[model samples]
Target: MKNLFFSREKIVQTFETLQGLIDGIRADGKIKNEEVIALKSWVKAHNYLEMRRPFNDIINIVKTAVSDHVLSEDEILDIKYVCKKFLDTYGGSKMGHLHGFASGIASDGELNEVEWKSLAKWIHTYDYLRGSWPYDEINALVHKHRSTLDLSSEEKEIIIYYFNDFCGLNKNSSLTHPLNEPNKPITGICAVCPDIEVYERTFCLTGESKKYSRDEITDKIFECGGIYKNDMSNLIDYLVVCSEGSPMWIYSCYGRKVEKAIAMRKAGHPIQIIHEFDLLDALEDAA
Candidate 1:
């Protein structure tokens, strides 16, 4: 009793799977289509072949599958916003492709401004790979929408094609960046470099912290511009040498200069030094 292409069942199922990926379920039910087929084999081989399918694929599938899923112009825009959050929390790949795909339909009047902007925002989130290859296909879809909408600065930012083919991301848009941006910088108020939020990194640092959640290990790395190699290796930027819950590794954050010095002294490293925070006088706001 759901609908045609997509049943009420499929819609519910789609969003649920998206949530599972976000929660790190580590199971097979979360995948669909060829991804499901390929994942079945991988799961049997390792029972832990974490999903790598692009999030854009899922949205496209859902859109095509739902027979009654006709979207109004505003609805198209709304869906695009949801797609960003879904992909951010759930993970994705080839975001620019999704944008180009949408642009083609919306530009040609097969879709509307809402759809065009939605696809554009998703694709625009890309820092690189915008308006390249398939993008021409997307661009050729409709110049009318491109010229007629008078999109806001933020909406326009999504399609500016800046940095050459690298034009993605509506610099003016306030939406959070997609998770797929490989070099997307971390944003938060962490005073010290945050640890990597990945499972492996969290596992490595968990048992040591009494008050910490396992998720915060890699989160610290994200805060501090650190790396996340799959397995534990010296490739790590810092050891985070722990002294009974006190961090042993000294971080060089913008404002923690004095604390670093004190920490060094406590660890018995010779020469008193100031914490980065204390040394940075001009950074009073940070203090």
Candidate 2:
């Protein structure tokens, strides 16, 4: 049963990656021959996922869409609809897709004028994400460099690093050389110390913690008269994001749960999203 659960999780993650790749290819508003080739290659590379429902469906759709070396508007819409249905069913977050889109656009290792403009347009289109972690940071970075004819090597590397970290792809090694200065601390984490409550309230966790295994965290929650849920929902009272980084995170420092919490909060649910440290403090206080 455990293995089956993990297998399903892997399939969903891969599907999200595919969505990101497709979004990246379309970012520039025009898909070139080479981009089509790249897309085909990506699908072929993930052919191992063919046994899964959506993968089987997506693989067939992509194969037919690009089989003739031409991607028509109808084909694009078909692919989009399939991906949308899967996301809607599985609760895929827009933030996750946004990070994937960033990773996709930068996968080629170059940011061109068209791609930059498209990225900016995307950020603007999702204005609701404005004050969230990484969104504001990314928005600023895109606008700051929009006027440049070509991004400097360092600038490009910074953007790439952001995308990699955001997409949980920065484990083991930096994608580029270490910067002389530290990268800015991620913003949009709750700026004020939240008054956290534990007893009888439901909690959902995202990202990874440097200090505790998930089981250990759940144990602590149980000990503190709190409940831990594996999925995010409107009933959750708090969404605890681990401050540490991990490759397992769908988004590096945060994940889909955080996005859902943000959306929930925006809708007036009073759900408090806090860092693991804040959770620790609350646990200690409860103790």
Candidate 3:
């Protein structure tokens, strides 16, 4: 609390504030009526509506937790996860953890074993101080250094997080494969549809392939005068779904980019999602 740098103090203060809020409701491991009333009052007081949708989602989850009159352990974890996610996504400095831990010792107005364990667990589990993850920077760093060399499990986790969080790409989006070139090919035509030139037509690809390697597929796309992208956007003309029925395939497919594509289609965009075989057939026809 003393001799602290101004910025570090601010981050610590913010962390403690959040910790206090969460602690207030979960003090007895059950949410009481008074706690629910207090939470509602806090929600009504904060103008987080102008912020991201997740903030509102946090509010809603609090309401749901209170609706049951008992907050389950799973609900507490969910709340914690969302709060951690919000902090990770938006802001907080990693260096402020020491102060937060120090202050959090007395967060529940005591340095008891339970409070200590909670502080330790929270400190270890969440990167509370590491404010504002540079998702774009991390993603760019990964892509710039990406290679055909198989990624280790940790590396894969990093890339997957980038796709899931930063790029908003789905699990179906192939990260193991080298990313396709963003630029259009110099020249080529699909023999099956030579009239419909693929050049400058942005295409987002998803799912794993069986017959052809991802690189081969990307090469064929480039050879067919198409622009290959890793995600679906209004700029995308096609979505090449390679495989289906993966555990979370449905959820990942309906992610932000695909939903955006759907909306764009409704607005008269000419985007189409085709299977890998369809793509292969087009290439074979051109060949």
Candidate 4:
């Protein structure tokens, strides 16, 4: 508490102020309570000078929300993106730990970036986690960055904290591929994405497919900096396909058939691929 650069009371105040603005957005449109809370938490962690960009953009969103402006998912993500940039610049230690924890959550269960970020921030900042985490005298357990999803809290703390000791800081730990009934099933998602790298070797098929919900696919594209869209004209770089079953449908364009559909519409090809893939999944499967 000594020499505090930012106080908890002020942060909570900011959330309250933004909540009123967001209420206006919700009045015009259906802004979920969860999303509103996430936005407030993102704003609460930082000072105004550092948060201007996200805050201003959020204010605009509020104004737009009041008018029922067409807010795309990417635009909503921008709020989190800007907040992330702000946190990176301002230094988020517990936030950083939550960042890592969020990764594990995604590994075990399905979560969008927004949901993941929200979960991490909430777990780290809420009275439950902040007041409860045993920050002192970390027990040592060498985990080699192994997954602790199944471990009890005591076991997890021992594994993770000791993991820090074993691997040292800056260690890139690998996830454990466990075989068990309760474990995550094989959910492979094939994505035919555009070459999104800003450097050389651009415009090629991206590998490392996701396996789970479409949300996972979107998170992948977001990580790669690829934009997800509804059609060929906007499908700038990549065409993605994801499913919990059948990678073999790939030849028939299983998940990727949409791109082929758009191409077919332009060049004249078969259009049966749409029935095989879920249209709703394609739309929501983004960062």
Question: lDDT (CA) for every model shown?
Answer: 0.31, 0.67, 0.46, 0.33
Tens-digit lDDT track of model 1 for 16-51: 333322211112112223222222222243222123
| Ranked candidates, highest TM-score first | 2, 3, 4, 1
Q: What's the C-alpha lDDT at position 164 in model 3?
A: 32
Q: TM-score of every model?
A: 0.20, 0.49, 0.30, 0.22
Please provide, for model 4 over 75-178, each residue's C-alpha lDDT reduced to its tens digit, 9 standing for 90 to 100: 54554454455545554444234333332222212323343234433443433322111111111011111223434443343233322321112133322212
Q: After superposition on all CA atoms, how large is the RMSD of candidate 4?
A: 19.7
Show model 3 residue runs off by greater than 4 Å.
Answer: 1-197, 244-249
Top-scoring candidate (TM-score): 2
What lDDT would candidate 1 get against the real structure? 0.31
Clashing pairs in 2: none
lDDT of 2 by residue, 1-287 (tens): 12233454555656666677678877777777766775676667666655665578888888888899987878988887887788778765466567667777775556778777878888888877754545544665665556436466766765666665545445532323345243422233442355688999898988768899988998999999999999988778878777574211223335457557756654456677666787888999997
In angstroms, how far off is 20's CA in candidate 1?
18
Clashes of 3: 5
Residue 237 shift from truth in candidate 4, angstroms:
56
Q: Could you tell me the lDDT of residue 208 within candidate 4?
A: 35
